[model samples]
Target chain A: MPKGKDTALMSWKEVPFGCYILESGNSVKFKTGDWRSFRPVLDKEKCIKCGQCYIMCPDMSYNQDEEGYYIVDLTYCKGCGICASVCPKGAITMVVEEV
Target chain B: MLKELAKFKGFSAKNLPKEEPFAPGHRACQGCGEVLALRLALKALGMNVIAVSATGCMEIISSPFPYTSWRVPWIHIAFENAAAVASGVEAALKVLKRKGRFPKNRRVDVVVFAGDGGTGDIGLQALSGALERGHDFVYICLDNEAYMNTGVQRSGCTPYGAMTTTSPPGKKSFGQMTWKKNVPAIAAAHGIPYVATATPAFFLDLMNKVKKAALVNGPAYVHVYAPCPTGWGSKGEDSIRLAKLAVETRIFPLYEVIEGKYYITRKITKPKPVEEYLKLQRRFRHLTEEHIREIQQRVDAEYERLLRLAECL
Candidate 1:
């Protein structure tokens, strides 16, 4: 588990139990990329730049470069293969990660 | 086919908002479908909304002590009163807005996120009251089928013939004897403006329904089909596959009701047998061939009934 924001001033043991609000942007510190066992590699040659991969990625890990094609951010990608499944051109393939 | 698929053509990561209302790092199980649905729904709802979460998996996991995954203003209510709390929030916000306490240009959406136990059984009365009173809020029931947080006890939404802690199968009886409750249909029966069924397997559809539900004037209900790998005894990685199978098999049809009018979003052209779905979970592992056939018949009948409802409008 990632350390929450402002742990010095507030702690789980100290806070009163009930309904209370937390500051925004606390969830960004947690990275889910380690959950990936299979990573998706994009073949630019077969890619149509149709943006289907970008749309279907649940984690929003796809980033569009200056050339207008999308790139996957491996830091947060969970390797769900949704992009590859939804890709009409079959440009993306899921490959097993070498241990 | 091209024209039919064109509706989703331009959607890209660039189009999505930069803000992350519900953050990661809370203690949700890996590949948890309920968390996935919550993420998509919160993404669609954006930063200007307030959420009331009922006591369940999400509530327990997201807000454990000092750490919280929510970025927006969220309230953790009881297991059966999220709708009531949200209604109160909406009413208070309305009066505050009238008194010029808030900016005239701003609109704060009141939303509820409850599990199947909270919505289908414990929270039904409060939910019905909120909807009947015409509260301007979006109520989302992330149905994971049973009381997952409380050691997998069977709830009202638990489907027939599935084994749970309280509904184990034996020589005299099969698991949970009743069918899954149709919470969305009950919501529509209240004449709410929007009532939709969504699954995390279809991210875009779930996002669209959440957005629509947020914008409705009266009460809106979005019943999301969230599969629980822990309780269902399935591989964590196969969570999305299990959800997709549920949709493809037409066992949990993806549809919506707009002011009593039904619309089937993703039509199952050639529905697969329910056994394909049942085989994915260990809860149904004890089911015999005869039991599977019975489940298939039940699914087919339900699908036909949904089709008829869609045709009525």
Candidate 2:
């Protein structure tokens, strides 16, 4: 996840044989929240919990709570405003740098 | 083994599948509909499959060094040989099962994900050969309308009057003078078992078609109209809306061809004008009124032709 690390510093022995990543879905270790210029804020009162935002988020940032309300994890949300635009009830709104 | 949806049922809003085969944290562009389509696709097919990716946006974003977004087994092949690699994978699986080296009952689905440039242009020959040879694999073409991975350039699947780096609209010429090639028709011509056109806007329909493709025995090709907000010069939030308009305006008709029989998936009874679809993307912003009319007529005619084919069934 370190952006400044030099690739040349790594030894050839550290590379995976044939470059096959043994850990599946290992990309989750890298957080991409900093890339977003905007962040989505949910209005809990207006949410119908239709799961629309949860399914539609390209970043897979939304997770449903036990109460059936959807919460966006800023760790991966790209602030694309898709969730706000797709929300039928206008529960989610995009704001600048809320995170 | 591939679990076929015995009944032709679609997932409702409340009961959608919760599993995510494509993980987050990879660097796909914000609001990238292509990756969203890929996510929905792998979700529909489940994790019991092997995915072969061509050198495209999906390949680059999903796998970077020691990290991979794919939870299932994936292979990255060349720009023009995803189908070939998939064919080899399917053949190897068959041979291994027959030799008792693997579980005889295990039937892992082989699926290929290729971009527009890879599918309709570079990989067309390889795809044709694999389909003709009757390989048990599903080839999904994620068409973003141009060579988006290598920067926006004209592709065989790029629509007429659309601006790209290579097909720039100027005083001398209009963007993409030629009409979009009918790749799905070409696939249908191969006389394969399954062929479909879907968009991520209709998530249920897209997922159901993918499931059905895996259910079918022979070669299956699903052409997905994925919106590239970054390349198309459109608002990221408009990706889904644009795809929906593409269907409603009759610009990209949704349908399926099963063993030479055609069936229109989402019929648009009250269609909107083609301009409604074109005006959203800056790629088609340079079109004059006459050009708009030309595109409208062509889209309507193409839809009518498809309707006639569906009617024959």
Candidate 3:
């Protein structure tokens, strides 16, 4: 976890189980058997690089590399469908990854 | 000694769990009713539960990046797939339980939450599929009339003669020309184990219905009338009171459909005029006297039908 950063990507298992904590806390710990990650697969053939998926993602999970093509960070992606919904062309799909 | 023993055995508010599964700090609008409904639903479901929310106001506001309002295991799927996701979760849990993957002594309940646009419109098909499959889960529709998350667009659940982005009232036409879809009746037609219509104004009754739905082994549906202050153009603090007036005016009746039987939970002995409910919100400000009369007649007819169903029960 980075210092002074309120939100950091961590496994769900690191958080204490059955404890209710508000989202305002700077640090988060997950519980064992609770961590799940969602990976975004972008088809290069269908990629128009419109940046709609990158812009619409609420989690800011996607980023543009040196080539200007968008790539998603699976470690932090919550798998909400703002990207796919806003994508004019069918370009994005959320795939659940094994923890 | 006997009095002290009885006191210990009796129910006390303090004995109830104080954990809030829906924590504060989400970006729900100042007076968003869906947020209140989520809070109350969490209070009913407790900590040992997972919530599947559809794409709507609650999902967007509460789940922006590193912030999430939910204290429970929450999943946000597509706009019209909350019930389907909940069904998958329940099925997975069942398989895990059978395979000893989950603790045999403990069980987890699944709840699906969706807004009116997602539930009454886009998600109805998926919801019906889940109910028909007899998935052991609770599906709650926090109906705020229109698609408030999408800039107050009119949805099928919007009431007649109400202004919306899509159903704007004009010189030649009334707002939302069509009447609101009868979603509770549609759920009742599924012949599910339990179905009920509730509102935030009646907190105890709403919680009771949620508890009953949770205990049922098969599919259960709870439609909650959540007043939207921003969409309805009303005072934010008046959300709960307006919900109460909706029931009093007989516009949105409080009732339950259990085991193919209809039970009217809150019956207005002397129903107030429909104007009393409409006059509170600016969305219905364009309704003329004739339109108000028409709306009242429709409300009376619906109330009569509900009364008939109760009688048959």
Q: For candidate 3, please provide the TM-score of chain A on its own.
A: 0.57
In candidate 2, residue B241 scores what lDDT?
89
Per-model DockQ against the true two-chain complex: 0.26, 0.80, 0.02
Model 1, B224-259: lDDT tens digits are 999888899987657777889999999889998877
Model 3 CA lDDT for position B134:
98
Q: How do the predictions measure up, each by TM-score? A: 0.84, 0.95, 0.74
Worst 10 residues of 1 chain B by lDDT: B1-10
Q: Quote the true-contact fraction of every model.
A: 0.24, 0.78, 0.01
Over B1-313, each residue of candidate 2 has an lDDT whose tens digit, in order, gives 1234356566677668889999999899988999999999998999899999999999999988778899999989899999999999999999999899999887789999999999999999999999999999999999999999999999999999999999998999889999999999999999998999999988888998998998889899999999999899999988888988999999889999988989898999999999898899999999999999999899889998999988976
- Ranking of models by TM-score: 2, 1, 3
Which clashing pairs does model 1 show?
A: none
Worst 10 residues of 1 chain A by lDDT: A19-28
DockQ result, candidate 3: 0.02
Per-residue alpha-carbon lDDT of model 3 for B235-281, expressed as tens digits? 65467668889999999999988789888999899998989889989
Q: CA RMSD for every model?
A: 5.1, 2.5, 16.8
